[model samples]
Target: MARRPRLEPRETRLDATQAYLGRAADLAAEFAAGIPPRRIRTFSEAAPDDLRTALAILSEIPDLGLVVHGPRGCAVRAPGVAPLAVTDLDQRDTVLGSGEVLAETVRALDAAYAVTAIAVLGSPVIAINSDDIRATVATLGLELDKPVVWVRTEGFRSAVPATGGDAAADALLQLVDAEETEREPGLLNLLTSTRGPELAALARQIEGLGWQVNILPAGASVADIARAGRAEASLVLAPDLLDLFAEGLETRFGVTRLDVALPLGAQATTAVLRRVAALGGAAAPPAPPRSVSKPLAGRRIALALPTSWGLATAELIGDLGGDVAALSVPHLDRSHAAALASLAERWPDLQIHVGEGQGFERTGFLRRNALDLLLGASDAVAGALRQGLPAAVLDPARLIGAGAAEAVTAAVDSAFARLALARSAAQNARPGYTPGWLKRSPDWHIKQEVR
Candidate 1:
């Protein structure tokens, strides 16, 4: 029972559960209580796994070796996910202890590559199996003379897949030199959860505010992550998985945490810009007056994305005069109080379907509702096309900073411009579900979880 790094589960720490089946008001109402009542889907399909998330985040840090201490299944098939060395724990290792497997992988990674640091990723199997690897990890760190962190990411630990981001943050905290807590003047942490291509323009906009930006965990090296403690403040962006991350920085290093709402549209982006500029004692340059145009006028749109992305994108749609008919998000938590309130106030009748990857519900929405566009990169978007709904696939990369509104508007225009393809797709569409199932309510399978 050696001392392990601080790796608190987002479920226990934030009371952020991914299990909810409700609308905007239903979910927004739950915020009245400290912990929202848990809801479960009667039927479920694809969902986010914490392990996959942790692996993705960790692997993104260049030259950081990772070992997945789980079975081969969870370790492999992480398409475009990792350069991981999995323990591949067998029945024998599960019973006899798999520390050696982890140790061997760590040694192999260290011996072969010039990695800045090494991390051991946990999994559901290892969580259930309860094989301790703390002592081994600490010994490896000392043995290799590099940062070796244990990212506690069990797939089933939390309903919100973003909880894996929290785990990765917790593990990454070990890299920050706690001994050097002196604040670096004008250094800002542009904390985000997007794996989209490099965000040079976004960083430039922040740098225009007179602060050097440290874009973390995404396209960041081990050194960039290491110097995070000294940043003057942190500005968290969309994909709102940085609650624990920013909190940890503030708590540990006394960095200012500007936990603002996701900047998905023009107005919200300006607000974020103004906030960041004001922090660096620099005035945001005056711009021409915003001209509001309703490109999506008379159009009804539905979205299936992460909570922050859903709320912010929904707001962006509203800003552009598009009618947001429905929204499907992964999970809802207290951190979404402001965004939820804003959405509820603006579109009181906005229907909200909460779940990560429930294709049936998404398909049902297509069968029942008349939507001009469906916003998501999920298979449901294809279903929408087959059902004659124009869909603008969401890219988390473009949904930030000054160009967010422009990017979305362009995407919407492109989607609608190809309306003929969508109509043809619907006309020639093969049957996916039975007519009876189509007639039933999309959430007919959803039932309130009785306590």
Candidate 2:
């Protein structure tokens, strides 16, 4: 009797499980043991600590209301976003658990809005008091028709800010049905932040290839999320924030996720569209044509962005004939090792600053190096400008497609032309830190931690 042919093992892509948070230097170092341990200033408005990150994620979900299960201060609102109902636990309520307050708030929010889902978020006060968020949500769910999700977002628990977003995504995934359905051949679930002009352009690109794009959580309704299992596959626009949600979708409904770099530059955008088109069994459309009025040749740029975005931005800068002189990443993890390696190969001598609020270090670096431009978040851009350097805030929206590429080129040219004006303003403006103090070792404030 002939033995049955050996079954081939199916290839599995690296999902969010293998990810881990660490200092940027440790991540970039060839040997982790050889690297010096240091605690850099690790806070920024872009992140604003982990609690804010969780709140921000929940706020983006359309028609989903939030209940901050803590004191009035914990009920911090994200500007122009979702409505939040706070428990407003006081000293008396803290002594005797705020369960009643939570219950009342949930009921009030349920009556106030026609929300499809309600997220009950735990703040530091409630977390410390050991408030039973799960129990409260379960009890409330019995009376309410809408699904209630408990998001654990205690500020001190998570070291990496993105974990807060992960928790929010996990809670959102609870709303998705477990049972699989007939897959929609030309439907793609775009796991991203929200609907914007950039996202619209990306949707159009996919639509051009005969595929329909579903923006999750952002503009997605409860019905859309419930039927997410039917999509052909999920594509992560901002993997750092949405990879966990994508992984959850795949696990629950057999939906595959295309884990690729964001569609920032020409190469990355083309690669994204090609992979998406292939996944949906649609014909890949011709790459959009780009015309650069002024190429970034011989220009040196420094970037301050998250790892994934920074890597893609570096590639875009390179494609436009500019050099990524230095970059600052919020946190580095194992999940980014492959991309980091690729970047290292391209720029062997790239300078990487780890953590945030390193204005002193950034100022010193800009003054020391012959940098042409600084591209980063608002704070970083302002810091660069105050140092008499040409700078532009790195807008994620301006990194989508050919039109985005042109926009970036135009922004760079504009910043370069305004260098003299920026320098004059810097001379007149009151300095935040003295040049002498900034001249100290870039790691002057960083304390080494031996683990």
Best by TM-score: 1
Q: lDDT by residue for model 1 over 1-451, one digit each (tens)?
A: 6465556665666666565544667667777656676666677787668887777667767678888888888775444333568788888876666777789888997887888899898888776567676677888888888889888885367767878888888888888888877778999988875655335766787888788999887768889988999999988764456667788888989888886666655566677778888878899866536756777778888877777777888887887888887887777777777788788888777777766666677777555666778877757578788888887787767777667777777878877887998999989989677888777777776665687
- TM-score of each candidate? 0.92, 0.86
Best-matching candidate per lDDT: 1
User: How big is the RMSD of model 2?
Assistant: 6.9
What does candidate 1 score on TM? 0.92
Evaluate residue 162 in candidate 2 and report its C-alpha lDDT on the 0 to 100 scale.
69
Model 2 residue 59 lDDT? Answer: 81
Off by over 4 Å in 2: 1-27, 31-47, 94-96, 179-182, 287-294
C-alpha root-mean-square deviation, each candidate: 2.5, 6.9
Residue-by-residue lDDT tens digits, candidate 2, 333-410 = 556666776767778677777555556666666666678888878888888888788887767766776565676777
